[model samples]
Target: MPEADGAGEQVGVGPWSGGSPPDDPRYDPELLAHGDRRNVVDRYRYWTVEAIRADLDARRPPDRHLHVAIENWAHDLNIGSVVRTANAFNAAGVHIVGRRRWNRRGAMVTDRYLHLHHHPDPAAFAAWAAHADDGARLPVVGVDNVPGSVPLEGRELPARCVLLLGQESSGLTPEAQAACDVVVHITQHGSTRSLNAGAAAAVAMHSWALQHA
Candidate 1:
């Protein structure tokens, strides 16, 4: 049973208390012996990292799973948040363009359960998308409030596609924009010129999920 704090909110389950350990391979013996306080859903409380990833892969829809790509040239702090959001949406994969290393603190360690890819630059990323093993040529949809971009609110995102995002200080680079099949912007009615990269990703992913998930 899980122990509650002084506020009466349950934290995490205690170690396995039954007479004999279950025969499931998915459950980790170490985690079963010790409490699982990791920030995972109830279904994965005692599962190993590999088991959780395999389960997520099994649950992913073959034809409709979405992918997200982000340019990491500037080591943007928002990338972690975007990765975390992608995990929540069960994105098929995440592509990191420009730089391979990124700050992972904001992701809350969710990246451990996601399939991450690294591309040296936008051109390489575009090339990989064109010849992905799945054989479906995924359209690169750039999410930025730039000129000539269509509104994203009612747009029908591709059932299988990569939602590409740019850096925080500058929007999409020339190469990235050129590689995009189409560009869409989240309509804004507030005083801010644009949204934070993480917030923008969440809205764009939610928009895609609404249409195809």
Candidate 2:
């Protein structure tokens, strides 16, 4: 397993050493000629971006039907981290409500591998969810610890549902919460008021994966 590295530490493999590169079309000639230093799995070391995305799409199981929605009204930095986690979990798609342009630094370029959508506001997002292209009206499950919320533990998330999260500082705007079919919250033993948006997203995604993935 490749260990996570900090700045200045070498990552990924060097250029191919063989006389001729593989004839496979999926392989990127430039990467093969030079080196594959992108932070990717070993299987995708020299693969082109399009090839990697296509492979991932082909291998995705139908049962892996979870989607993620983030409220980007504030251009929250946590949005990028949430996107990276969504990619890790192989979410069906990611929806950005409110602002289209978000801080992507925390994503580390993982967004390129996932399908993304943008909505003008929570109402627009909710409308789309009600009549998605697939014909399945996916439930919008909000993750926040506001009033009248239920604990997420042991909860059975819908197989084809969207996990919605709000901005880091002000979680789940009234409009966003109103758009949700059901609101769930993570149980905490610590004294902290609430979990960070990124951490909360990971926990909610993991919980859904545990139940359905």
lDDT of 2 by residue, 185-208 (tens): 999999999999999999999998
Task: Quote the RMSD, in angstroms, for model 2.
Answer: 2.6
Error of 1 at 146 (Å): 0.9
Name the lDDT value of residue 133 in candidate 2.
39
- Candidate 1: list runs displaced more than 4 Å: 1-11
- Model 1 accuracy (lDDT, Cα): 0.89
Inter-residue clash pairs, candidate 2: none
Pick by TM-score: which candidate is best? 2
Candidate 2 matches the true fold with a TM-score of 0.94
Per-candidate count of clashing residue pairs (backbone under 3 Å) = 0, 0
